[model samples]
Target chain A: MNEVKKLPLQEAANCLTPALRLAVDRLPEQTARAAEELRLRVGQPPALSYGGQETALQTAAVTAADLREIVARAARDSVHSYADSLRQGFLTLSGGHRIGICGTAKVENGNFEGVRQFGALNIRIAKPVFGCARGVYEQCCRGEPSSLVVLSPPGRGKTTLLRDLIRCAAASGARVGVADERGELAALRDGAPQFDLGGPADVLELCGKQDAVMHLIKTMSPRIVALDEITSAKDAAAVGYAANCGVEIFATAHALGLEDFRRRTVYRPLLSIFQYAVEIALEEGERICRVHPLKEGAPC
Target chain B: MLKLLGAILIIGASGALGLSARQGLRMRIAAIDSFLKALSRIESEITYRLTPCDELIALLAGENDPYAAPVFQDMAERLTHNDGLSLSYKWSRALREAGPACGLREEELGILCDAGSFLGRYDSEQQRHSLRLTAARLSAVRDEAAEDLKTKGGLYRACGLTLGILAVIVLL
Candidate 1:
């Protein structure tokens, strides 16, 4: 009912098209507060997912032309320069909200080119939970700046927690470098961050995870580095490489618990590199999560 | 003396109208040339730098060319400020709004609208080709306008003087 609850909805609505805006503007205040994503699929009515539940909107069905118009507006009328993001099936808007694209992939000679004629869009609203990292820094951040990995299922506030942690680390005078592959962590616009991350942290926007991690380590001297959604082998290797260089790495992944975290084959190298793991879960409308110290000889 | 003064006034007014007509043609040709030059820059930006249409429009607006800048500025403004309108709609609107001031005819503005339809609708290669085609068409329009200016320039002046003298004689 206060200013904080209205901020995200206001920003999200500003980016919504006119038709979508009509539907979004009618959402209940509580639903709007928890609204995490707005999904628009071609030929189907728009839907909203928030508070761990999906609800269909009483709005007109989206069309191909409407989707194209949304894409054009999101790209700010520049689809060509956003080729890489379009190829990756998502593009981050100015406010750090990522629009996950779904469409046909353009392939050439056994390699993927980019998305063609996107039919579905998942607009993920970035909710930076201020002070979310209050009690966790004391538990995980220990001697020698031990590497930490935050784990949770999707939409469990992993990025939000990570941003606060990065801010806390930087506030304590530890130089932090964030590899913002999707610009979500920093939400940079015109080379400046939209979120108040407690202190100034060096960020690399629109760069691939592996390359950005290595590049940040070399160029920006930092005691710690942060990235989101470590999903690839190259990303694991990059985290491994950073850990090997004795630069503390703080990152996130999608997993329920430590057992679930160790089950992924690609995450094996990354798992070994982290001495501390914080597992987050959404329970009873509250964040139930923890920081656990990993043994030295834990099996992959 | 009264008849002579009346004749002089009539001739002067007609002569001014003819000069104005010729000047309108000159301005139209100048606008077309400036638009072509701006389109060339947009083509390069798309082909090489992969600039988006909005950024290209912003760049064009900043170029400060008297003929092309206002039109580009209008486009950039409309795209950014007008939330509900589609890109093509805004583009056509801006061309229509800026058309009369720059001595652009409805057909000339329609030529721009045709080009603007392809602005943000394709990949870089496709967009670059569209821009080239648009520039060619605008160049041809400019050539036509130049031809009109050359042929009608003296004729307008002569007709203005002859028509004014005839009007005075009839009145007398």
Candidate 2:
């Protein structure tokens, strides 16, 4: 490897891979049966829907030997310490759960920046809650073009809703391409997905959301592309680009109430392309829903 | 009779001295053993990180595509961060040996010896296999850190005990 590429940032990822991969491989097999049993036999609180999934227990096996290997690996790369990994980002094995991530800040444009340094990752040990998204499928997909914008005040079932809706759309013969950026939406069962998303609806996971969206649009010509969170302007632009191509979009966002969603319309740089903009926002604990006929000069 | 009594006293004294020396040797051995175990484990991890990078390089080189060369930036960070404790153990061992060879062979042992930015450059992966490498790296880190702490803790105690026993023998 060249010197520039063989840099600190490069080594950082190299240092983290082994543990995560082992966890990924073992997580499914190990946690599959136990986590399934736990989700079923565990508490069924009304507020909490047991997505019937297991927690990853890989970190549970993180012995002293594993740690030493990490240190040793770092040491080999000329790194004197490991604490600095947190300043950037670190894959937290949340007791065998794997959450891979990039650093909080980089020397980008010869400057350092990002949100309050997000160096910790939570690998949401994904479980196939067979009926997890069944609750929100209809709400997300009931439209002519099905231009949905699922909103939740964080920690809500937006992704699950999106996942189920993809299945719903696919089942209905709509070609869906899910930009599963974090392996959350489709929760790839082993190598394949549990949900029968028709005719290999391409799931561009781990690939950047915007890039994946663009790729799917150009190549697949998907009838529907289920995007997770429309956070960045780039993502908005991609969605808008996809919509311009005449393909419907099934997307989600983060918002509190209808008014908040209305406010978010300003962020609808790309959202204006969709003829129908169905906003599903959460107010208090309940979801106060609305389906808007989006047109030219309308409140996006 | 007096000569016999003197011999017996001397024998008793020698026996006590021998026991103390044996105890001291045991302590030192324990210390060295713990230190070596930590060092060896940390050493093993260098191979862990390098293997994937090499494999990634090998795979990409054959294809003549940089993009195709997989990356594991996240995993490298996890391995280096939690596993930095191994440094102190290695340092401790070096102190005992009082030599450069004992300290660290940077070329021979691929330990990114400086804990400064252990997790430097694992950006992302092009394939699923790289993810598996990431999994292994994280595990090595978690295991090493916990092990280092336990071993170092025990080793330190042993060193102190050995010194204390030596001091007692010398003073008394």
Q: Pick the candidate with the highest lDDT.
A: 1
- The digit string of per-residue lDDT tens for model 1 on A107-169 reads 889788777777898888877777788677766764335578899988788989899989878
Q: Output DockQ, candidate 1.
A: 0.61
- lDDT against the true structure, per candidate, is 0.81, 0.46
Residue A262's lDDT within candidate 2 is 62
| Candidate 1 residue runs with Cα over 4 Å from true position | A1-5, A108-111, A282-286, A296-300, B1-5, B46-59, B62-64, B72-91, B114-126, B150-155, B168-172
Residues B12-67, candidate 1: write the lDDT tens digits.
99988888888888889988888888888988898889887778888999997999
Chain A TM-score for candidate 2 is 0.56
Model 2 chain A: which ten-residue window has the lowest total lDDT?
A39-48
Best by DockQ: 1
Write model 2 residue lDDT over B12-131, tens digit each, in one string: 555565555444434333433333343333334333443333232233234332221111122222334554333334433333233222222222123322222222223211112333
lDDT of 2 by residue, A177-208 (tens): 88866555654532565444556478875567
User: What's the residue-level lDDT of B67 in candidate 1?
Assistant: 90
In model 1, the number of clashes is 0
In Å, residue A51's CA in model 1 sits off its true spot by: 3.7
Give the count of colliding residue pairs in each prediction. 0, 86
